[model samples]
Target: MIIPEQTRNNLEFDKLLKWLSSYAHSSLAKRIILKLEPFDSLENIQTRNKLISQCITLINEEGKYSFHGLANIIPILKKARIEGTYLSSAELYTVYRQCLLYSSIKQYIKQNKAIVPDLYALVEEIYEPSDFMRSIKATISEHGEIFDIASDKLLKIRKEIKEIAASVTTHLESFISDKNNAQLIQEPLVLDRDGRYVLLIKAEKRKEINGIIHGSSASGAAYYCELLSTVELNNKLKVIKEKEKDVCREILQKFTNSIRGIANELIINQRRSAKLDSLHCLATFAIEQGGCMAHFNNSSVLELEEVFHPLLKYKSSMIRKSAIVALSLKLEEPARGLIITGPNMGGKTVALKNIGLAVLMAHSGIPVIARRVSIPYLKALFADIGEKQDLMQNLSTFSSHVQNIIPMLNYSEEGALFIIDELGTGTDPSEGAPLAVAILEHLLFRRGLIITTTHHNAVKIYAESKEELINASMDFDISTLKPTFKIIPGIAGTSHAFDIATKLGVAETIVEKARSIRDKKDEAYLSVLEKLSEQMRDLEIKKEVWWKEKNQLEQKLRMSIEENSEQKKLLLEERRKLSERVKEFLRKSKSRWEEVVQEMKAALSEKAYSEGKQSIKEIEQEAETVLKVSIYQDEEPGQFGVND
Candidate 1:
């Protein structure tokens, strides 16, 4: 999306950028954040926002991670990219530290990949040069010093130098201890002068020292001289020291060559790391500011719920969160323009700026400070906020405003946003109000989404008359004679100038005289607007009460449903237990019947035919009585038989 420079300045977008940059870990990341612009494609914007969201998740799951060792390695990498150029030990240490940071981040992302897949994906694109890091760690110390173990030859040379230096010191001590030469020496202590051991000797006894004089002291009373006995040892030590330096140089060059081999990978890793750092800053800032990514739609409708001016949070240290009033606005089909009317210092301009900033922030892939928001992707954003008087061009405020607006009108397109504050105010109201109406109509006809503030009653009336326009106002408290800083849509606003003046200690007589001299038609219109504002306020209170009652009812309904579900579960469990008891009772009754039938058969086999018939009859009667008793004993009161 193309946002004009003037619009960005007018909305104080740079202030937000500054806030974002403050959370960056390095200069590279800060630079990237400061130069952020709105992406032109929805896919890119969504990707950026998703990455930030993932970062937020990571921070919440694990406490914020510190990138302490991360540094801008671009300059060092550039030098390494050139052939035969070796980085200094300190510079190479910086590169190593950055590599370690990369590895740490890679591991961190891998551990939390399940929670932050998008962040993991972003880190996965960067190369992890484990071999390169191991080489650096083996060569350089954590304190940016080259270690003695860097190379075999360097170590061997250092060992020889250490032995020779000890031998040279031994020779110097032996010469000093000899009583024959003790008087020639002014002081026995040896001093290191330009990497060679020397001794202080009396200037008058210099000829008796038999040594090479390095220099004389400040008073010229003493001479610093190297003893002749240690001269050969000192020369060997000097030659070995030079050799040690050559070995150290070779080690550093070899390390630098290794870095150069992977210079391209390092460059790519640095860029990706910087981008991740920027994402971290953005996510942190969003969380601090109570922000969320707004839903984007392809339609022209714009909806904002409980939206506040983002800068208001930093406006004053004494300002509490509750002191900032959030406003809600919705512009759908046929309402292409919103005309806000209110008295001076009533926050009409603030509302306009907030809307513009919200759009810009959302388009730039930054979360907006709002409870809920859904905005269309705007092709262009043009704003005419604050005074535009151009002293350099000798143009009046009205001329400058017109000049700034002419291009906006020409470039008006579908899905474009235009925010104008105190529109058509620099010229005479008689002409400016009608001109403002005409301009608004033209912009709406071109299908541009517009939000403009005006104090002109003509513009407000014209907005009320048009189906394509909606009239809104910054709410004022009549009892307190102060602006509430709350925006109310679908109604015009009264200036309430006289009432406010009276409250501010102006004489009642002045207020009455001013009111009487006002135009009758304008006064009547303001009176209606005041009454309408009162009705709107009452309606808002009623709506809030209704919403609370509705939520309570919904909660109660959910509880009822859950209670019913639990009762059903318990009822089914009880039925299963009762069924098992019935099955056991039936099994015992069948065994009793089988025992009676066997007794009847035994009686028939032992007696005549007539006796057998009598015996069977007796058994049948006994079995029927036993069956009835068993049924009565097993069944509970009010419970039917097995069929039930």
Candidate 2:
């Protein structure tokens, strides 16, 4: 989205920038945060989301990663790019660190292609040839000290430097140990002074010494002197040291040549890495804030639920985070705008701000702190939230608001979201309220999402009368005389100016007088609104209580049903076992009766049949009683009578 700079400040997107930029590892990333704009294409936005997903994974696993060459090399790179000069050894080391970092990442991405496909794809965009990195690593030490192996001539000259330095050390040691020269020596320590080896000698013995005085001691009692015998050798060493520097520069120049060969690669690498860093920071911010990604659509269908303002979400130390309420605003085809009216300090401004800030954040590709949010991919934002008085230009707040609104009216697109706080507030309501309605009409005609707040009763009444504009309010508790700090949709606030004034210590007599001075029709209208607000407030509280109780009942009912079902299964299992026992008893009775009947028949022929019949009747009666008892036991008290 291409919002104006002033619009950014009005939406307080800078505060969001501060929060996001804290996680940036480089100036490049920080600059990206500052210059954030919505991507021009949906593909680009999805690409960024993919990058963010990878960054989130990386960060959660290993935490913060350092950016190599960020501390000292950025400015040097710029200088090299503009000036085209050979770099020093230390400067080349910085570039080497950068190259090494990217090289390592490239290798990692190549190996873990399946794990981090998006990140690996991003890494593939850079044309980093590892040949220069290998050369630089072989040449430079970890401490930025160029190795002797960097150049052959430099190595040979350094070998000569060591020899010359050894000879000079021998001469200085001999002079200190000499009995004749021992008395002249002060501390007997040889030191390098102005690129020449020198000895601290007594000032009184300076005339006896055959050397040049280089510097005097702080007390002026001794002189720092270089021996006349070692001058030729020192001069030769100086010449070789200069050559060493030239040779080192030549080696560094060779590395610079390697860089220039892949100049385009370096630029591409930096660009891609910088974009990666930016994504990393944004993802870091989103994770910290517990936010989710927002998608875009073509129409002005804005549906935001449970979204907190960025300022309130990020820098709300003074306010309790749990106490801060998330706002919900939806604007569809018929509902083109929302007109919110509420008591002072009742979060109307914050509601308006949340709408604008969320739109901007989504358009800029930073996820919003909402459970679910869908907004139009707007091209511009129109906001008039803050004090816009221009002292130098002699413009009033109304004039400034009008000036901002003018451009918006001319260029505002169909999917734009307009946020106006306390609209029609800077002037007399008699005229300002009508102006606000007229502007609302204009915005409706343009077909955009407009969310505005006002205390003007006329604005609220007009909004209530209109079918297209929805009236909303921040609920306030009349009993406690405090704001509930919640947005209640389809209800207009009473805007109890007199009640608030009285609560703030205005005299009761003054309140009464003010009430008496009002027009009867206006007073009656305000009175009816206050009554409606009370009714709505009570209704909302009751609704909340009802919903809470309903949820609790539902949970309890579910638990009870589950427990009863388990108990019923146990009962059914027990009944099944009892029925099997009854069957077993009947089988045993039949077997015993048959055996007895056989014995009776053998004992007495005439009475055998009658005895068996009696035995059979007794067994049948016993089995019938057992079945009745089992049936009675199977019918549990609640199970038989209560089923939905």
Which candidate leads the pack in TM-score? 1
Q: Candidate 2: minimum summed lDDT over ten consecutive residues — where? A: 625-634
Model 1, residue 24: what's the lDDT?
84
lDDT by residue (tens digit), candidate 1, 460-518: 87776677788888887766766777888777787778888888899999999999999
In angstroms, the error of model 1 at 239 is 0.8
Clashing pairs in 1: none
Which stretch of 10 consecutive residues in model 1 shows the poorest summed lDDT? Answer: 625-634
Residue-level lDDT of model 2, residues 1-644, one tens digit each, is 55777778887788788778877888887888887776776677767767787777777775756663443345666556654588776777777777666776666556656767888888886666677777778888878888888778778889999999999989899989988888899888988887788899999999998899998999999999989998887888888888888888778777777766666667667777777778878877778877778866667678988897877766675465465678877777677788888887777777777888887787667878888788766766788887799999999999988888887688656667778888887898899999988988888788777888898877876776566887777887655787666777666677778988888899999999999998775675565455445544554564455445444433444354436666656654654565565567557656655654554444333443353346356545644353433222225444232111
State which candidate has the highest lDDT.
1
TM per candidate: 0.82, 0.80
Error of 1 at 524 (Å): 1.3
